[model samples]
Target: MPRVIGIDIPDKKRLEIALTYIYGIGRSVSNDIIARLKLNPGMRAHELTQDDIAKINTLLQNEYVVEGDLRRQVQNNIKRLVSIHAYRGSRHRAGLPVRGQRTRTNSRTRKGKRRTIANKKK
Candidate 1:
């Protein structure tokens, strides 16, 4: 695994995909980073050279947050949402679908095992 901006990116994944593991770096940001650093999008993480690491590190530190800072930012956002009592926040509170997906027919994973209705007695 190659370490980028103090975070280890998995060896086998593409640069964009691997960067997503570090938090805050998604597809668009990864593309921008690669473009700015002149890095190959298809390059495997572990194949990166020392110079590549330096360039990527510089880019991340200069313009983007990763790892611990990114995590804290996300937590703070969630906390703020919860404090505001938004629908998504309520979904987070209830651990159910936030997007108004049909809870009656779907959301088995969130809703857990369904109750079985007993057959009517003859």
Candidate 2:
């Protein structure tokens, strides 16, 4: 494993793919970083030299909001929505889907286990 910004990326993978192991960095962003840093995307993560790792670490710290910072920022955004009583916030608070998915039947994954209602016979 090769450590990048405190995340241990799989050494067997290509550098571009391995970079995506870090939170907030996806395929496109990893490719962009590799391109900008003039790194070989085909190179394995374990093959990187100390200086190369240092450069990557510096670049990520300076130019990106990642890991804990990104997580906190997302949480803050949700909190803001909740404070303002937004519709989406209410759905989040209720543990329902926030993307207008109908809850009549298909939302069990989000709404949790079913509660049966018994009917009285006449």
Candidate 1, clashing residue pairs? none
Backbone clashes counted, model 2:
0
RMSD of each: 4.7, 3.9
Tens-place lDDT per residue, model 2, 9-28, is 99999999999999999999
Taking the tens digit of each residue's C-alpha lDDT, what string does model 1 give over 37-84? 888999888888999888888878888777788789988987888899
10 residues in a row with least lDDT, candidate 1: 113-122
TM-score of 2: 0.88
Model 1 gets an lDDT of: 0.83
Best by lDDT: 2
Clash pairs, candidate 2, are: none
